[model samples]
Target: MAVRAGLPRITARVHLDLLQSEDGRRTAAELTRRLKVSPASVSVAVNYLVRHGYVRRERDPQQRRDVYVIDDEAWYRSVVLSARQTLETARAALASAEGAGPDDLVGQRMARTGAFLERISLDLLESADRWRMLLK
Candidate 1:
């Protein structure tokens, strides 16, 4: 999925699995074992996330290993920003139809579509807030 999305393949797996896991944190070795991928692959994904400000590296107090943690702000910003972009695109589509005939079927459909997109965009934002509360 990550590769298809133009991101490193192991990135989606490691990050999703780690965040879904009980502790929501994992060492490189743990990710390697759980993902059944090479250490290099895990390292590549972790390094990318670290550089992108999406993940943080923390030294394990008891073990001589680094644990990757998801950056809440970064994740939130990514999702919200994506939703914003989608909303903007929908708005643009509506703007393009501004001069269309009022009785045109396509214009009416576009208006409905824009309303739906706006509603879904707001819903996504609300859902993000709810998930953050759950994490807290």
Candidate 2:
């Protein structure tokens, strides 16, 4: 499944999908049982998901374990994050090339790329804002 999705790990792919499902909000033990993976594997994959802002972990008041949650806007957040990352990277590249001649191919390309990413990021952010307002 992960391979077909171009994802690096099966655990990550499954974990994310699971979090979006009705059976999500599970503890590590639950994920282990559901995913049929080792506890350590689930832990590592869940950690990765948390790091990427793809999933959130919340303490379950009645239990010692934490619940893993995937927000309804998780995918929307991911898209905006990707756009922001691209824009930031492009800006960094252009900034680094600031000392170069304007006619320099590398600098020119960097500037163009930065502008393109900036536009894309802005559009995505606007769309996200609209979605939020509409969802409210």
Candidate 3:
């Protein structure tokens, strides 16, 4: 339900399927079988999550299977990475706004947004570190 709330139907289903499994890991076939989803659907969803660093993939040599594991730090990594990405985006915004005329509305909006994101990025990093320290 939580997954469904945050993700599209297929991706949520895949995440839930693996999360509900016994060991927090499953082969793509296993996920497909469990969710009764098409292989391509699983592949797409798994790839998306993996690309976002939410899922960790490994290969089983003997079984020749691709196992997808739910990363314990999935949330942390996702948040931190997004924050860092926002930082980069903000930098770009600031650069683009550099030569704009003083009355440029777009430039003004960009500047404000960039400054906000910059602050948010720093706050997010600080909070993430604090959370990590608390967890330890």
Higher TM-score: candidate 1 or 2? 2
Write the candidate numbers in order of decreasing TM-score.
Answer: 3, 2, 1
What is the full ranking by lDDT, best candidate first? Answer: 3, 1, 2
The per-model lDDT (C-alpha) reads 0.80, 0.75, 0.85
Q: What tens-digit string does per-residue lDDT give for candidate 1 at 1-136?
A: 6578877668988878777878678889889999999999999999988876678899988987899987667677677877888788778757655646557888777777777887888898888877875544
Task: Give every collision pair in model 2.
Answer: none
Better of 1 and 3 by TM-score: 3
Q: For residues 1-136, write the lDDT of model 3, one tens digit per residue.
A: 7554577689888887777878889998888898998999999999988998879999999998899999877888888998999999988888766667447988888888888889999899889978975433
Residue-level lDDT tens digits of model 2 in 92-126: 87785675658899888877877777787888888
Query: How far off is residue 90 in model 3, in Å?
Result: 1.4
On the 0 to 100 scale, the lDDT of residue 133 in model 1 is 56
| Per-residue lDDT of 78 in model 1 | 71
Give the number of the best model, judged by lDDT.
Answer: 3
Span of ten consecutive residues with least summed lDDT in model 3: 127-136
Task: Give me candidate 1's TM-score against the actual structure.
Answer: 0.59
lDDT of 2: 0.75
